[model samples]
Target chain A: MKLWKKNIWKNTILIVFGIIILLPFFWMFTTSVSDPLKIFSEKLRFFPEEWRWESYREAVSKVPFFLFMWNSFKIAFLVSLGQIITSFFAGYAFARLKFPMRNLIFYIVLGTLMIPGQVTLIPLYSIMAKFNLINTHWSLIIPGLASPFGIFLMRQYFLVFPTELEDAAKIDGCNVPKFLIHVALPSSKSILATLGVLAFIGSWGNFIGPLVFLTDLDKATVPLGLYRFMGSYSTSWPELMAATAISIIPLIVMYIIAQRYIIEAYSFAGVRK
Target chain B: MGKKKWKKSEVMWGYFLIAPAISIIAIFALVPVGYAIYYSFTDYSLFHPPYFIGLENFKELFADEDFWQVVKNTLFYLIGVPVGLFVALFLASLLNDRTLKLAPLYRSIYFVPVILPMISIGAVWIWIFNVKYGLMNHFLGLLGIKPIPWLTSYEWSKIPVIITGIWQGFGGSTIILLAGMQNIPGEVYEAAKLDGAGGMKMFFRITLPLLSQSIVVVTIMSVIASFQIFDLVMVLTGGGPGRSSASIVQFIYEKAFRSFEMGYASAAAALLFVVIFIVSIVQLKISQRITNY
Candidate 1:
């Protein structure tokens, strides 16, 4: 009986804490669709009493919603594709190729990781200004196309790959890019997915890069787009939350679809370091 | 050394493949770092050409009370790391139970905050933290407590910012720590159970001690992350009623972008680099030492 009680207690505690952790999200969601008057009422219920979801339509029409989403989508997709290609290419060179000064070059690339992004912010802004690229998406996309971390992730994987395959391909007269395209890529699908998903999520939700690089509301990504709405309609909690929900709903859907790869791969590899 | 003849195609392909990545890094990452260091020693407005002043920026930064206040606030923000970790560890321990049938479902719920943009988090939290007619004070009223100022007062502003951050942050750490927990072999628990170790005893003696490496790694990474906090702070309190809640990076942002004081901002950023670099080195050393454990 004591053990049964303890087990019950443990389960109850877990359920309660989970609810507490989820309350803010619940509040955000419930408030988004609730009436504006009820949102301001003294007694705010946890769940919405009515679904006035034109708030979604209202929020969407308030600004360039679709344009913001498109910019976000374009940036995230290009960043993922760009990082994957570049990281794979660089990773193979660092891992498999026996060129002179390979180790030295690899270390040099990795050493740049020590410099925090803040240290580079001022000069990057200046460089972007020099080239008249400050307000352009190219400024955002170019800086993110390659990262030492992504290269390191790929290089680590390729380092332990079977050398016999490489030697076999070499003796078979298989062309270099062809081997990577057919052989290496097929083997690295999961790791590549891990990188792609992470890159996509990071780029989609990014605020600082867009905040610094892009100035126009039309050019803004989703997060800053929502923020721009908030500045104007700070009093309208329902509309703001509705906009907020719209921004993250896509990411949430993707996360659910790929939770298996994400939690397992990311916890061990991508985000931790 | 076995002088195996290198394939002409292989060496040429290597350079060809790496060219794009190398070019991007050279222009964006490498050059920016060099220019930042140079700018730190010179005075340059947005319009004027940079001129050498030789530590003028650094000297002004040391005496600036505003700079120190931001440094103090950023350090204060570090309190969120350990607090968030404790909650995450507790939650992970609960989720560690084998009988928890819906563990994955529950974990996904926890991780939702981590994947959301800071702007979304800020938008939701701002209404919740509202002084009058807010969800927080409404709850306080239900319990017969007075509504306290959450985001307005200089004294109490950091509390709400830290709480929101913890809410967003603890989830990711919980997920990581949960993965760490599973990595421990099942036999250790069995051995402990055979020795008649109680649940509490096993947690302290077996679980925590074994999980210390992961705990340390997560904690150090959290420290590094706390330094770069910007969008969240901007949304939460806008660094507050009078700069009481501004972070180090926010300080840099205001100086560099808002005021266009490139030299002063670079100096502050240089200091930030030193702080993070030191923390990162400690992380590297500690991580290397703990890998075998």
Candidate 2:
């Protein structure tokens, strides 16, 4: 009976905290559909008295929302795909292969993770300028394609993989690439998904990279588009909120679908480091 | 001869596998950082060729009051680190209760904010803190309190940004700490219980000491993240109400992009790098000391 009482108190507190955390999100959705004029009224209403669906229409039409989303999708898709392929092969080599200077090379890869991006921003921009890659999606996609963190995460995952499977595959006359494709890759679904989701969400939400590299509206990503919209229409709260809501739906959906793997993978990364 | 050829082929394949990633990192990360160090001593605007200035940028930066103010602001933002750590540890303890039902559901709810884009978070909070009709003012009004200007007031500007930082970050930290807590041996807890140690006592004596490693990791990460704060200040406040909340990174961005002072920006970035490098080393030393206990 005493234990039951404690459980009730604990659950009540958790529920209240959850509501407080979620209130801003709730307000965002309500404000998006609320009447524009009524939003600034003296009395704040939790639920909108009058819903205006036009805000969504105006929000998208006012900016090149589709183009921005397309750019974001393309950049994220390509970067995640590239990182997966590169990190997989590199991780396999580091974990399984016997090579000269293998440990030293792996340490070099780990060392890169400590250097923050700001240290390289200026010269990277100049290098991009030299290559005439500025204002192009390649600038964003290429840098993101080779993450030290991804390589490290993949290496860690591969290190623990059972060697028995590889031995069996070798006996069956499997070459290195064939073993990677048929044996290792098939068993790595969870790690791949974890890395894919992380890379996708990261590239999708990246602000500084897009802010620095892409200047044109046509090349803007979702965050950049939202920032531009907020700057131009500071007073248009409803439309701004509508745009903000629309922009986060993909992230929210992705989080919901892969919450377990995302949290586990990230915590593993943190703990292992 | 066949065996020798196979060994050679294997070594070649290993090199082939890692070459692409290594080359990209070398070009993008390593080389640019080298150039950043080189550019710090030279004046280069996009229109003009870079010329050696021989510490002119660094000399000017030392005497610049605005740079000092932004540095102060950056240090001030570190207040969020302790606040975030405390909140994360508390929430993690609560959720770590094995008896707690729907823990996964609650954990996901808390983590939702972390995954959302900072732009969206900034936009939503901007409305929530709107002086005239914000939800925050509405709550204050209910308590017979006057509305406070959240983002516009210089004194209050940093508060909301700090609050949002903690809110967005603590969820991840909480998950991390919880994992660390679980790794603590069950035997320790059993011994504590047998010793008649109360909840708080056990927490301090067992949980905290055992959890010190994760705390160090989280603290260092938080400090690094708070120092690099730009997006929140950019979207929410714009260093507002007379540069009250301007961070060092924001200043660097403005100098680089707005003023086109490439040399000065590189100097500032180099200084930031030095500070971070020192802080990380210090943190490593401290963590090592704690682990020795």
Candidate 3:
């Protein structure tokens, strides 16, 4: 009986702490649906008294939701596709190809990992301005296409892949592209999936790049759209939270769908470093 | 060395495969860095054709008090990175206990903050930290103390931003650390317990030492993230109270975009780059030594 009580107490403590951690998110969702007056009310309630979907409607209607979503989708899709292609080839080159200065080039790319984006921001900005690329989607899309981290991640994943398969493919008279396409890619589906999800999520959530480049309202991405909402309607907590919820919903869904794969691949490879 | 004849087709295909990536990097990353280096040595404004002034920008930067103040603020910001990460690691360790139920639920709850936008959080934080009619003030009111000027006061402004940052980021650190902790061998802990090691003893002796690799990874990621911090500072205080909260990135932003001092901004950015490069190298060296030890 005493042991049972101890277990029960421990379980209760865990549950309470769990609730505490979730309190803000719960409040965000609740406030998004709640009346504006009740949000700031002295009486703190966990649940909304009345569930109103109007706030969500108001949030969507306030901005070009579809256009912004499309902009985000276009940029994110191109970025992910581009990263996958680039990282795969680069990763293969670093892992398999024999060339002079390969290690030197690989290390140079790895060195880019340490340099913070702040260092590159002004230089990139000036270059973009010179091309008259500011306020253009290409400005956002082009820079994101070549990610040093993607190369690093792909390299790490590629290192552990067995070389016997490649050798077999070569013996079968398959060229490097054929070997990569037919054998290597088929085997590395899981890693590719991991990289694809990560790239999409990173591009989708990146705020600073879009903020710097997308000066035109029509070209604004989702995060920037949310920023503009917050600035224009500073008093509308309900609307702002609603907008935040909408913007993050897709990412959260993606996270849930890929959660198992993400954990498996990332923990397997991630902890090794 | 066995000299393998390179197929022209194969080499051409390799180049073709990599062309898109290289061109983008050249246009966006490499060229910008090159121009930034050039501009760092100039007196270029937005209108001017970047006339050569030979180290003038860097020279002026040395005498800029605001620049020094931003450096101090950035150091203050970086201090939270380690403290916050350690706390997160501790939390991850706790949550990783086998006896703990609903681990995924706990994990998701902690990770929620990380998914939310910094701009949105900054908005919420501003309301929370407001001196009058704010939640923080009201909570502090219960203690019978005067309301603190969180964003208005020079001393207190940066700290609240730092605290909010810690809260939002600790969840991610917890998730990554938890992932690391999951890799620890169960028998190692079992062996320690069999040797009459208590909870605290096991944690310090076994859990922490085994978790060094993750700690290093987490430290590097956190430091990089902290150095690039701009949105929260941009939204919350706008580097108020005479630029007390102006971080190096925000300073660069203001100089380049707001003031249109392209050359000066590029110089500042180069300095930021050098600092991050040096710090990251130091981290890598320290991690290497730790792994060796």
Candidate 4:
């Protein structure tokens, strides 16, 4: 009876804590649908009586929502695809290839991770401006294509892949690309998915990249588009919340779809560090 | 003959495979770092030719009061990291109870905030911290407590920012801890139960100690991330109320972009880089010791 009593108490505590933990997001969702005036209505309502769906409709119409989505999709898709292809090949080379200065080059790549990206922001901006890449998706996509973290994660994953199989492939007269594509690529599916998802999620939610490079409203990503809705003098709380929800919903959806892969990526990133 | 040539081509291909990565790092990452370092020693605004001023920028920064204030705010935000991380780890352990029917749903729900862009989170939080009609004030009112000026006052600004940060952040740490929990052998718990250990004792003795490696890693990452926080501060406070809540990064941004003091900004950036480097090395050394034990 004491043990059972303890269990019930523990469960109640967990339930209460969980509710507290989820409250902010719940409130955000509620506020998104609630009327601006009704937000602080003297009689508090946790749930809105009549959902104002127009906030979302107005948010979509005010900004080029589909264009922003397309721009974000294009940038993220290109960056992720390129990052996977480049990081995979480089990871394979580091993990399996015979070459002098391999470890030295790998160390250099790892060292870059410690150097904060903020240090390079202005210089990179200048360079991109010089190349006339500013206001274009290439500015964002090109730099991210060679992600050090992806390379590092992929290298660690590739290192554990069986070398004997590669040797067999070579003996069967398969070349490097052939061996990598036919044997190595198929085996590293989980890690690749993890890397791809991580790269996609990061590229999707990026603000600094689009803020610095993409000056045109039509060229801006979701974060930048949302920024347009905000003003220095005042803010549209309900509309801002609506836009915020819309901007984040796709990421939330992607994360939900690939939760297992993302969880594995977190472990991979955490332990490998 | 063709096979011999193919072997040679394969070796070259390996080098070719890494060329794009090396070039990207060299052009984008390396050059910027090098330029920033160079600019730190010169008196260069964005529009002017950089004149070599050799440590003048560094000298000015040593006496800068605002820089110190920003540093203090950063450290203030950093204090919440360990508290938040451990709380998340605690949450993870509870949800790791497989007997719980909705563990996956609980984990995903907790993790939802982590995936959201900081831009959006910052927007919602700004409203939440509004002095009047804000949810926080209204909620606090229910208890007959006076409303707190969350972002308006210097004294109160950073605390609210830290709260928002903790709310958004704990999810990532929880997920990582959950991953660590899965790797531990189930038999350890069984053995503990056989030895008459209950929930609290087993958790303190076994689960936490076993999870220490992951905990250390999470703590270090969280600390680094917290110190370098930019977006939330940018949107919410603009590091305002007389620079009381300005962070090192925001200070650097103002110095570089707003004030156009590129040389001094670079010096500040370099100083920040050194400070972060030292902190990271110390953190790594500490984590290394934990792992070794």
Candidate 5:
């Protein structure tokens, strides 16, 4: 009887908390479908009385949403692919091979994690400008091609890999690069997915990078597009909500498909650090 | 001689493998930082040549009222860190209950905010904090209360952003803390229960102490994140009602891009780096002490 009572209390609390956390999301969806003129009605309706499906159309039409999404996708895909390649090679070297100044170099890489990106923002901008890369996708892709966190995660993953497989590969005349490509990478699907998802999520949602680097509206990413929409159409709540809903649909889908890996990756990073 | 050559080749292979990553870091991160340090000591507007004016920008920043206000605003924003930690820890403990069914569902719901883009969510929050017909005011009105200006008022502008920060951050921290809680051995809890310890006592003594490392990590990360807050401020408030909610990052952005004062902006960025470095070092020492205990 006591155990039953405790369970009841626990569940009740959990449900209430869940509702609070979910309220904004519910509001976002409802507002997306809500009548713009009626959104400010004194009695806030949880469900839209008239589903204004046109808001989504209007939101898309008001801005180049698809263009923005394409821009985001392009940057995210390249950055993820670049980060994986660079991090794999670097992680392999740091984990499986001995080199001069190895520890010192590893420490330097780790120390970069502490330095916030803002510290290098101005000078990087200047460099990009000098190279005439500003307003180009290369500005977004090149700087983020390698990340300390990605390398660190990859190194940690590599360290735990069984050495016997590598030794066997070596005995079979498999050189380091060949073994990495044929053996190690094929077996590292899970870590690769984790790293790819993390990098994609990061670059996709990135605001400041695109905001600073890509000044053209045609080249703006989703976040920047959404921000521009809000700026120009501040009073159009329904349109704004609709645009937000559309922008998040892909992320929501990605999260649902790989929720476990995403959550575990984040927690692993946090706890290990 | 053959063995030595093989060892040398292995070393060369290692260097070759790591070369790309190191070069990228050196070019994009290290070189830029070096330039930033140098730029902070010069007066470089985008149009003109950078001339050395040692300490001038720093001197100007020290005397700038707007900069000081941004500093205060940033410090005020950090209140979200402790508040977020507490909320995350509480939710984590609740979800950690083995008796709870659908815990994953509940967790996924809470985590929804974290996965969404901050800029998009910031837009959604703007509506929620809307003065007249917003959900927050509507909820308050149920208890016969008047609506408070959540994002418009100078005094109230920071509150909504802070709440949003906490909300968005709660999930990540909860996951980390929950992982920490899971790592604590069941035997310790069993022993505490065997000694007739109450639930609250066990939590304070056993759970919190064991979870200290995660707590420290979450807090420091939260602090760093909050310090760099720009998206939310830009989207939600635009640091408005006269720069009341402007963060240092926002200030740097405006200075660098809008005013094209690269030197002054670099100075601000460098100072912000110092502040973060100090806080991180202090937190690391504190966490180290706790872990030792």
Candidate 6:
């Protein structure tokens, strides 16, 4: 009876806070479908008083929404792919290879890991400008290509992989890279997925990269574009919400699909850290 | 990892494998730290040759009221870290309940916001904090409380921003703590239950003591993350009414990009690095004493 009572109390607290956290997502959807004038009514309508779907149409057609989405998709895809491939190779090297000064190199990686990325911002920007890549997508893609954290995650994952497999694969005449591709890669799918999903999620939401490096409106990603959208249509709450909803749909869909990978990633991060 | 001796080809492949990542890190991350340190003492405005100005940038930055306000706002903003962690711990404990069958659904619901772009988050929150037509005010009105300016007033502006941050943030930590909770052996709980330890008692005495390592890790992550609070603040408040809520990063942005004060901004960036380093080291040292993991 006491356990049941405690369970009931726990449920109430969880549900209430869950609703509070979920309110904005619900509100974003509701406001997107609501009538423009009805949003300001005396009655606090939890749902839209009138379902207005044109807000979505207006939101998309008003600006280069798809273009921005494309830019974002490209950046996220490239950044994730780049980070995964490079980190996997480097992680494999650090974990399994025999080389001169391997420990020293790894210590440098660990040191850089502790140094916050913000510390590198100004000089990186100048470097970007020096290379005449300031307004281009390369500025965003290049820096994220070799993630220290991703490398660390991969290294840790690889370090635990059994040596007997490597020894067997070597006896089968497989080269180092070949063994990595054929054996190790398949074995550590979950962590790689985790790293890829994390990088995708991060690159998708990246506002600072676009804000500092790219000034061209057409080159703007979703977050930067949506920010600019807010500036223009500040009065049109429904339209703005519609735009916000549109930008988020793909991510929410991706989340639904890759959420398990995210859980794996979180657990990996927890244990490793 | 066995340190078995390898052939020349394999040894060369080892260096080949690392070259790309190391070179890129050098170009983007490592070299920049050196450049930031060097340029932090120089007066360069992008167009001209940089001349050394010693510690003038740091001295001026220390004396500048705007810089201090940035520091003040950053300190105030860090309040979200602990608050968010507490909320995360509570929610994680709830989710940790074995009897809760709908845990996965609730987990997804809580975590959805963490995955969304901050600008999308900021847009929804801006309207939620709207003085007249906002949902926050609408709920307040239900309780016969009048609407307060959530984003405009000097006194009330950061309130909604902080709440929004806490809402979006706690999910990540909840997931971290949930993982931590799972790693706690069931035998410990079974022993506690035999000793008549109640739910609250178990959480405080058993769970928290075991989960201290995770808590330290989460604390370090949250504090580091809190210092870099940029995108959300930029969208919701733009550091607001009078630059009163501006973050250190935002200060760096304004000084470097807006005002073209490269040297000054680099100094601020250098200080930001040093501050983060010191705080991280302090947390780590403290954590070492408290938790053995």
Overall lDDT per candidate, in order of appearance: 0.85, 0.88, 0.77, 0.81, 0.91, 0.87
Off by over 4 Å in 6: A1-5, A233-235, B1-7
TM per candidate: 0.94, 0.97, 0.90, 0.93, 0.98, 0.96
What part of the reference interface contacts, as a 0 to 1 fraction, does candidate 4 reproduce?
0.54
> How high is the lDDT of residue A110 in model 3?
68
- The local lDDT score (0 to 100) that residue A200 gets in candidate 2 is 94
| TM-score, model 1 to reference | 0.94
Q: Tell me the tens digit of each residue's lDDT in model 2 across B205-252.
A: 999999998998899889999989999988889988788999999988
Is model 5 an incorrect, acceptable, medium or high docking prediction?
medium
Which clashing pairs does model 3 show?
none
Listing every candidate in turn, what is its Cα RMSD in Å to the true structure after a full C-alpha superposition? 2.3, 2.3, 2.9, 3.3, 1.9, 2.1
Q: Report fnat in order of the candidates.
A: 0.67, 0.67, 0.35, 0.54, 0.80, 0.77
Candidate 3 per-residue lDDT over residues B1-293, each given as its tens digit: 89777766655665665566667666667666778888888887778778899988999999999888888888889878978887787678767866666667677666666655677677667766767645567777878878899999988989877977887787677777888788889999899888999988988988787778888777877787788788888778878878889888888888887798988988998998887777777987988887798
Tell me the spans in candidate 3 whose CA falls farther than 4 Å from its real position: A1-17, A233-235, A263-273, B1-16, B130-149
TM-score winner between candidates 3 and 6: 6
How far does residue A221 in candidate 2 sit from its true spot (Å)?
0.4
- Across A2-71, the per-residue lDDT of candidate 1 in tens digits comes to 7567668777876886787778778888888898878776776887777889788888888888899999
Docking class for candidate 2: medium
**Candidates ranked by DockQ, best first?**
5, 6, 2, 1, 4, 3
Q: List model 6 lDDT by residue over B226-248, tens digit each.
A: 78788878898899898867889
Model 1: pairs clashing at backbone N, Cα or C within 3 Å:
none
Model 5: lDDT equals 0.91
Candidate 4, residues A1-273, lDDT tens digits: the string is 865675576567677767766776677788888887787666667799899877777777777877888898898998888888889989888887767677899998999998886788767777887898988999998888888898888788778887799889989999888988888889887778778888888888787668767878999898777776675244456777888888888887888789988876776677657
Docking class of 4: medium
Ranking by TM-score: 5, 2, 6, 1, 4, 3
